[model samples]
Target chain A: MQKLLDYGPLLLGGAVTTICLAVLSLLLATLLGGWGARAKLLRPRGDPLNKGLIRLQARVATAYTTLARGIPDLVLMLILYFGGQRALNWVTELAGLDTLEFSKFLAGTLAIGLLYGAYLTETFRGAWLAVAKGQGEAAEALGLRGLRAFRLVLFPQFVRHALPGYGNVWQVLVKSTAVVSVIGLEDLVGLANDVGKSQRDPFLFMLVVIVVYLGITSVSGWGFNRLERYYSRGMR
Target chain B: MRFDLVFEHWDLFARGVVTTLELVALSLAVGFCIALPCGLALARGHRSARLIRAYVYVFRGTPLLVQTYLFYYGLGVTLGQYDWVRDSLFWPFLRDAWWIALLVFSLNSGAYATEIIRGAVITIPRGELEAARALGLSDRQVDFLVLIPSALRRALPQYGNEVVFMLHGSVVAGVITIQDIFGVTQTFRARYYVAYEGFLTAAALYMAITFVIVLIFRQLEKRYLAHLGLSR
Candidate 1:
């Protein structure tokens, strides 16, 4: 108990780091997911020559999602964290440049973002599909085009459809930040483990850590619910 | 890049594969046993439903890695320190990391399984229960002879996803010094300083296992769910 207080500030700092990592990775994931979703939803009607290129783009997106979803996140993280550094140095050496450091935080973010991007790709695609085909046609008929059409008409409906799944993905992504600790990142779990070891009472410290996680999850769950209600205001 | 290193460690990889399969299979089997009654209670609105929901929420809300560490380092080590626990007959099993890993994995999987089962049970058509009751079957008979079996079948597809997730989750067992497939990759990488080969091979193996699980579940669905098929 006394030990917990003594280490309180460190634990709080770790929690802040964990939250930052989750937010950054989520931003990356949403971007990749949007790009992948667009590539996947492409229709090859532009020209005879471009049709094959569009088909290839869709194929590559499919492969990325499938491979990402198939492997475990921890293994993927380790591969990227360790192998990425080696690959980076090899490239630098060939170009007569100094070896660059690949921070664990960056690798952790990239691996998690890439992994969840696959799931989000499906979620975003489904939401886009559910927006009613006629909605797009109506927008075009009213002289709204491309980004204007999506912003004015499509996105509001997409949020309503996507909120539930987006919430689930966010919850899981937050939990997965714990895995970054395995690679020696001083995140919440890592700091908790260190403190617990020094105090020689891991059980109590772990219980505290568990409560912290529960707090984060429940608070986010409530926030998502509010977002859902806001988006679904006019719906039945 | 290091194909030769992977081939040289083929025996270790094989053993790791067996251990990984055992961890997933045993934990999931035990988890299913734990889930069955809790799922029924929740689906039927039994008085225990509130307690079961709390259990599910706690287990699901936290990360599995934390749970693993809690069980192994936290509970296991804490208990092992007590004089009574050390003197007890159960000490032999408790002292082993394998049993601790199994216990945590089972409980974690059990929580997710309960939800899958409850969803399946509640979705069962009301008329089927009425038909069974109207035929003069006892409540227990209807539950066993109809509700349980049908829920199990209906739950098969979602449950298959759980199995793969469990397989992936079991990689944390490696963290606790269990030589599961992921553990083997870690050992090989540390020993040889080779990047990509061992981990890539393990990834390929995991993908293959996932494919096989998907195939097996598909076949089971076709066979058992034939009556519900579109062709019918």
Candidate 2:
């Protein structure tokens, strides 16, 4: 414990890394989620993309989510770290970019982003379903088309409706950032592991890590509650 | 990229699948056993119910990965040396992958299952219990005859979700070097450089398993909840 306090700077750095991973991944996930939701809602149910194509798209989306949600985040982080890095290196080689390398931060962020994007898809899709159809129709009738209607009408309601679930997803994603440590990311947990190894007091280091996580979870939970309240205003 | 290599390793994959199934089944069975009583006690507001609720909150609030590490590393260090515990007949079981995986997975799911079973038990109509009491039935009789059956119906949907969660969570056993489906894929990826193929195939297997489980859950719900104005 004294060692942890002495090495506070390193621990704080890890916490910062943890936050960066979560925030960046959350940003990417939300963007992808919105796009996925729109893809499902905007496309005509009877579009001539062919039944097989539609089924394939749906299956792909479902697989993305199942694979993300079903497997443990630690395993995902490992795969992303070990396999994904190799795959990325291969791509760089193909592109004739000799000696180019992907950093642990980028790999961790993108891996988590991809995984959480699947979760956000389900949350956003459910939120879209909850949006009253009349809300969209009213915007359409007022000459708002495509982007304008989505911005003016759909986005607001979807954000508000999705806030609660998205908050939960955000918490999950935040906790998931810990797994990045497994991938050699210098996230809070990763740093703790390093310190633990160096100091030979893993329990102390892990306890410190747990405390940091608890702090993150508590603060984020409070923030989410506030956001949920803010979005839920004017409802009976 | 290498179809022949995958074909050659089909038997390995099959064995991996079997191990994964065995691990999941063992964990789920153990989880259900512990969960039933814990849930009943929770719902019944028996002594120490508050403590049980707190237990549930901590387990539910924390990520399962942390729980796994805490068990494997923390518990192993702290409790690994007690002579009776070390030398007991259970030590052989306790010292291995199967036991740790079972213990962690069961406890984790048991926490969730408590909520499901409690909700189901409480959702049974108060009138039914009252009627049983009015019939001069013992409290135990009222519970067994009136409460338990009705509660099971109310709980089926959420319990189904628990089933899916436990099945999915079983994949995490791979992290501890248990050659479950995901573990096998990791091995393949290590040997063959076919990361995407192995992972995608494992993902498909998980989907297939989860799909079958979900379908069975649905059928069970329909059968049990048929009289409740529910339709498939």
Clashing pairs in 1: none
lDDT of 1 by residue, B1-232 (tens): 8799899889999999999999999999999999999999999999999999999999989999999989888657899889998899988777888998999999999999999999999999999999999999999999999999989988888898899889888889988899999999889889999878998998888888888887898888888778767211
TM-score of each candidate structure, all chains considered together: 0.95, 0.81
Tell me candidate 2's TM-score on chain B.
0.91
- What Cα-based lDDT does every candidate model obtain? 0.90, 0.75
lDDT of 2 by residue, B46-165 (tens): 997998897776666665656676666555544566787887887786678668888888888888888788877877777888888999999889778878778777888878767766
- Candidate 1, A12-95: lDDT as tens digits: 999999999999999999998998898899999778779988888889999999888788888888889888899899999999
lDDT for model 1, on a 0 to 1 scale? 0.90
Positional deviation of residue A127's Cα in model 1 after best superposition, in angstroms: 1.9
